[model samples]
Target chain A: MNAIVSAPAARLVHVPLGERAYDILIGSGLIERAGHEIAARLKGRKAAIVTDENVAPLYLDALVASLEAAGIVSASLVLPAGEKTKSFEHLMTVCDAVLEARIERNDAVIALGGGVIGDLSGFAAGIVRRGLRFVQVPTSLLSQVDSSVGGKTGINTRHGKNLVGVFHQPDLVLADTDVLNTLSDREFRAGYAEVAKYGLIDKPDFFAWLEANWRQVFAGGVERAEAIATSCQAKSDVVVADERENGPRALLNLGHTFGHALEAATAYDSRRLVHGEGVAIGMVLAHEFSARLNLASPDDAKRVEAHLKTVGLPTRMDDIPGDLPPAEVLMDAIGQDKKVKGGKLTFILTHGIAQSFVADDVPSSEVLSFLKEKHPR
Target chain B: MNAIVSAPAARLVHVPLGERAYDILIGSGLIERAGHEIAARLKGRKAAIVTDENVAPLYLDALVASLEAAGIVSASLVLPAGEKTKSFEHLMTVCDAVLEARIERNDAVIALGGGVIGDLSGFAAGIVRRGLRFVQVPTSLLSQVDSSVGGKTGINTRHGKNLVGVFHQPDLVLADTDVLNTLSDREFRAGYAEVAKYGLIDKPDFFAWLEANWRQVFAGGVERAEAIATSCQAKSDVVVADERENGPRALLNLGHTFGHALEAATAYDSRRLVHGEGVAIGMVLAHEFSARLNLASPDDAKRVEAHLKTVGLPTRMDDIPGDLPPAEVLMDAIGQDKKVKGGKLTFILTHGIAQSFVADDVPSSEVLSFLKEKHPR
Candidate 1:
């Protein structure tokens, strides 16, 4: 037997019929608790922890130490950080590194950076042979709250963000909220938008609590940590029910439709207006569009706007900062969105502050009017 | 609303549960027939088609012509080929190309290539402004029988092949049998592995039928076409039931674990083999492993091996074109396969033909022994 000894205690939630059913570990310190868990699942082997240059500098050593402590050997695959790093070329780099390191399936993969690392590494994990097993150690706020929880993974193509990839869920997702302390406020806030989306879509109680506890989340406190972790429960369950965003689970796209357009329109080059900030504006626009379409009341739009503004997210045109691209440019780019059915536009419009719908067949004229009104050139 | 009213209606099989219901259209001439079907689904104002060079060269003009014939204002994005091309850089190319084409939210994206193009384009559609609609016109056998039918999309990274991507099912999948003519005999043969898998995993009767009819299927005939389309139905039904590889549906990985190992051992280089060829060999190995373990009867192993060989697929070390990779090299690569969970291999070993189990905690030594026997040094 290997030197490692731990409970084969991790639970695999059977999504049924079988390979898609993933496990969820409500454990503590797994990022550094490698061997214990690895031994239980992997039968005591080393792991190659794939992180970014940005993340490895901070935690790769600790993860390596954990694997060693478990009597397992370990390696590090640290790539340069940036959204651009989450590309097929970078995925190839990781695959090559894994090959160079001779990482075996007997070993595990610890994706130790943020979403990009998790995605790049996890993606490498997926196709390393048609797949591999990896854990998610989300360093970025966006990852911990969103990307880390879903088995959804992939890199970007020149055509778009995350154009190529798969639904390769992690064996374990280690979201050390403590890591958020190291994140820039903007990145941390970007993650919060997804956390808040949960409340806005299904859990009004969480929304109420979020409104009350807005300070803690923005401030990045223990309470926010609990919220983010527990928030995973809701998302995980939703994912279990609709892992492909096929049903009600699509409510998660609350502000994504309009927000992504705005982001794409802007070329998403300006860091000043990150995804969360765009969502903040997009949610407002969605509410405004809903009101305009008589699908929602102005009060609902105002409520969503207030919630975002209160969280210090931008709710208007001036909120878009940095060298911005034109609205027409973003619109043109957004035309490539996957959500478009045939040649028609689809929108996730809200009926109220917390109720959303993935409205198919929405006319472009109406959508353009929404865009023109919200961010007039 | 541009020209001819070609209502290429998609034949949708609802996996149920509201929104997750996707369409699977299996008919004669679907890939070439995409424009009208896609345009009809174009609940939007404009549409874009994402493809690769190999496909675009053969099909783009016709697709564009078909769309124009339907009076739809369409645009196209042609990417390069191989796993290498599904990168963020290429994704950007599509993004730029789409933007240049003046697409709108009311438009849709047609993934008019094989799996690579479908993945990149589909993912682009998925994330574009928080999601857009996309139609899949799968050209490769792998895509037609497998990938194109599922909403799963994404790109690769330095880490792996399809490590990054999303599970966004297509509004419709157009599987045109005519496209099979374009693939080299090797590629066509490679895709047949998956065709073989469906039968091997769940339908022994289908397996028997394959033994009877594969000649016609490969040589081109109504029965072959029926079987191919039926294979899509088999997978589509399974996907509708599971959507993700979470349940009994995971039975699909019958040979994938070992196949992925072999492929990874080769770094997915085409020089060694195509993805399907690796899978073909892996299935034989799995059957032999089952027989060796006394889990499956020798006759079952013989039957499985015989079928693969009958198709001219490599079933033994001698059959593997080129030198067999070193045993240790192969085994070590196997160790990195994502299928290995915890230190044990979770193989889809069968008790007999069509009776498989997701056996976890299987000793790696046994795995190495199986390979030693199947792909001896």
Candidate 2:
């Protein structure tokens, strides 16, 4: 009998959830042995492959064959590509498709796509039959760096992105580096924001590495591999300690609080802006906000702006275009923000580089004024 | 400082998710002191309460008052009542409402209501800023007994029920039995299904206890007050051990695998059959299925039916005006179930009154045959 084995790279981080905490095996060659790895997670004789259009044409068939090799019959559910698919209607359609294919709780769901696929499919895997076994086969660099490492899954609604979802951890996360080559230049760059975020949140070294090796990531070189893998390790470490985002895990939202607001303002499912672009701008805003409050030296704040600009990411509203939303709009966007409590604004500000604090007293007025500074001139 | 402490009779069941593991605190009057207990899980001064029309009108102000007493400023978001409100639109509305309300990341969200409210609020909590702090204040027995303890949150779809969702655990679960007194008779019975499920899934002694004191549950007597708390403990213990339902946790599906199908076929929001009523009937079907498969004795099946019926539950499909729905329809409903994988069936059937086996068999033909027997006029 082929028993499940943990990946060497995954061991760099440990899941903090005792029995629920398990290892995440990430590598270019990881997919080859994935069947053996996931066999133990199944209690039934079949499997379901949930993927999106982008990744399906590339690896769907191969994944199905892998499951078949493991004696688990497989069926596939291919969703339309892009963020638009992460909706209530789309989620139900996927459920219809799952039922149409006869997926069951005893069987496992192999999420064979990028972040959007992983989010929607992970969510599908999370709630189907209350919960089904799922293995993440992330085909995007961003997903590999952040999404695949954590078990957070959900769909987007008109109100906001990922507003309806769960923290359903996967049985296994198979982040194959090989798929990175398939991404377009724009897509590759988009995923890098998270790579950058790991540094902004906790891994200062990884951030420094990205600053030094930005070209390698863009050129797809040797250093790029280590950068993505290192980012994954950083994320995995945090997630292992705080899988539910109730404590230290909230630190991961370094760019997201503001980033999500901007994304929601523009319509999350639209290509008007990728999540990374928003975060790129959010990082700059965060530092500026940090400096405005005397939490960080203004020099460090400038460095943040310059570094994000060096990678060709948006640092202002004009970068994406349209209009500078009013504070009420921004407030409306941030108000429904996950950080708010009883109308209190919680801002994750930095006292300095490698220093962060969660505060509800940044004041909406400050948030609005700072965001206004980013107004296109 | 008056810390929110568990009831004297409250039993704690710790979920085993490494650092994410939290105890399910069960007892009467737990909600009155939830502010202190849940506030202990945080380091901030803000709290948001997401509730519904019916529940909020009755307890929202009281909850807010309690939070203020604890020096925690609280905000409340009240939506329309009923399961139909558990929609994609509502999830977005809530997220935006909260974000616009300026809730802080340091502030936590208190999910207060029955199952729908718990699910939608929990789901909203999941994606806001990538997950806000969550405290479940279950107001109904169903919410208290099942939805509160486990972090399962989501919305229903046009195709079926709970098709879109996630597993977002609460930092603390506040199941105050006093809330149950406000439930209508039907609502009370609906809540009982989840509580009774604990006994059916495991712990025969608990099942016997139910048989002895079920009168008190309907009578709403203190004699069975511990029953509410103990039932939650049983569930919380199992969920803690298997937070993601990989193994031992599946036993909790004692009647859900089939019950969800009935809910789907009948349209769950219709109020024609409350979830527990369907579950109560489902327990009967599951027992019969087990006996037919010779996994259980005929006597065991009879006792299971008798208990549910004595509690004013329907033991057959005739309770609702639905047809036998062809084998294909039954197949379709089961397929739409959150547990389907690769077109196969996974039924958690009882081998006896207190033993449930996650069965990978019970072929499509057998299931169709069973449906024919159970649904035939």
Candidate 3:
């Protein structure tokens, strides 16, 4: 499982969204093949590539050359890196640039970075001419496994994260696993948190597989591609079941509620706590809180925490370097999450691994007390 | 047909786009009954009303009072009036206001003005939280007959008008005819252009009826209601056939190719010429151009011009109140239209009245020569 190779056969995950359906191709060296793959599928020969400054320096040229080689004309916009780029100002800039390129309805806008670029560019694609064909060339593990497959494109407002956007699915997704090799150790671990989330949601067998083979995944082997494929497949099923998050899709928010609150508590400073780390802690908290409610055994929570810790992920809130606001302050952030309905506390609590369910109207007092107990003294 | 009355029974136009289908209710006193009508359909009790200053002074209070009477709590934002308001700046302000109002996914955002407000507010409603229930309470004649029905919501950018937007269908539309009484004569005449448009698009009988009943439609009687209903049904059928404007929908732009160029020439200044007036002139041009191409008889072009002129609409370029650009420049603006694909000219030419058809690959030189012939020397 840990054997390293030059390349592997590409794997495909089809998002079954009827007319909006698309394919996600995962393997090493897929980025070099992006232009040919896209040209084969789409009718238009024009594309606008949106990437961050960091990614532009690394992958933008190769992607452009590939496109030009395939007789596809391309223009590129390189934005500053990070989460703050998911904003209305940047959305305006991206939109203007795409329009400036004269990319029409059938032409494509390609997202070529991590979540920030994917979300913002997808949003711009969604609105420019009421929607241009979109393609995702996710350059980070987090995006490849998550944002790229889901068409939830948006920008954050002063009001909240992802508070403005549209559901504009991509025409195709190219997840080049080799790019994950360029991510820092911390970023890689953070992405693994979401990969683990899939198993925790409904696949105990996959969770056990990760526990045994996560190291091979980190080592950039066949297991890594398998893990990413499985995560995308899991998400695709949920999206097909409920594209708009009307029902069972809430399960995808398993640790997102607490994760987002923690992100807010830190002012979204990635140095203090990146999204995946917050989610790592939040997932453990969810399992532990469920145990306190007697819905799951304490041993299950411990097992989950132990596996995450072994992967070098921060599984406790105190793992965050900076001082956090009081538990009640974090609670306020939770109340502000878009997922909270009519001020009711909605959470995904687990009965055990692979047994998560949406727990709505959970009393605020109980959540506060649990957070208080879990807070650093 | 011109008999005056206190109120009239509401007329309904159902846009059947499957699950996104909605109803447009047209009548004399629908505004006074807005709250009851909305409450009957939507589940959410919270609404955010977006109206412009001109409308706020007149109908905002009545709309608010009606909503309140029906047990709906609401918040209102009054933007400045005019076409400039349909922009990214206003879009951000509206999105922020909707978020600040805490209007959730299930809540509603109601647009209570003309095309600018409806387009901008509908865009905000479409994007805030991926989508919110939308209601359009169009307060102008142009909106009631045309803009309010298609579910096309967007904002203008430096690139062009409606260059950015989404296809967010409204849950309901209330086009109260009594509001037309408040429009200035010019504004009313401008809106009548679109009513004439529906007839020119596909209904020869409707065009003939409007020609015979022009005085009564202007007098605000049964003919007015009948004309509005017929226009909406025409638009509804077109929208149902091509909700995204991919195919048969292009016929709806019969006059728009010339109309949009005229608007762009005036920099969208209402003091010079408004949208419907531009369409009136454009519709005439389309017919004449068709005659030049021998696709339609010259008599048809004369009839369209005669009917529009009788309704007090501008039916020619020189009717505009200012110095015009050269026909070449107007043709340049037409080239920049989003509908123009790959530099090929596309125009809605007619075989005759009620015989509009999309003509693609039209020769640009032919268009330029035709424009020169029509321009005032």
State TM-scores per candidate.
0.65, 0.74, 0.97
True contacts kept of each: 0.14, 0.42, 0.80
Q: By lDDT, is 2 or 3 better?
A: 3
Give the number of the best model, judged by lDDT: 3
- Per-residue lDDT tens digits of candidate 3, residues B249-298? 99989899899999999999999999999999999999999999999999
Better of 1 and 2 by lDDT: 2
Candidate 1: tens digits of C-alpha lDDT, residues B1-377: 44544445334443342564656676566655666777566566567888787888888888787777666778777677887777767765765566556555456788887777888888767655335677788888888887787676766655445555556767777777777887888888888888988888878888889999989988875776777777887887777677655556667788887777667667677867777887887888788888899898889888888888888776654554567677777776666554555556678889888787778778888887777776666
Q: Which candidate comes out best when scored by DockQ?
A: 3
- Candidate 2 residue lDDT tens string, B3-62: 555546665666666766777776666667776776677866777788888898888877
Tens digits of lDDT, candidate 1, A139-194: 77777777777677777655566555666767766665557778886777677777
Error of 2 at A55 (Å): 5.7
Judging by TM-score against the true structure, name the best candidate: 3
Off by over 4 Å in 3: A1-8, B1-8
Off by over 4 Å in 2: A1-89, A105-114, A133-141, A144-147, A152-165, A168-217, A241-377, B1-113, B126-164, B168-217, B224-230, B233-243, B247-273, B284-313, B316-323, B326-377
Question: Which runs in model 1 stand beyond 4 Å of their true positions?
Answer: A1-377, B1-18, B31-33, B39-47, B50-60, B77-134, B139-143, B150-168, B178-199, B202-204, B207-219, B237-242, B253-289, B295-315, B346-362, B367-377
Task: Give per-residue CA lDDT, model 2, range A1-377, as digits (tens).
Answer: 44444544432244456756656665665666667667755576677788887778888777766666777788888888888888767766666666555566666778888888888877777666566777788888888888877888877756567766667787777777777888887788778888887777765776787789899877765677777767877777778777777667777888778888888888764457888888888877888888887888988778777888887777776787666566568667877655655566777778766576667666888887776666623
Candidate 3, residues A1-377, lDDT tens digits: the string is 22222345899999999999999999988888888889878888899999998899889989998888777899999999988999889999999999999998778999999999999999999999899999999988999998898799998877777889999999999999999988999999999999999999999999999999999999998899999999999999999999988889999888888898899889888889988898899899999999999999999999999999999999988889979999989888887678867667889999999999998889999999999999945
Report the Cα RMSD per candidate: 7.4, 6.0, 3.9
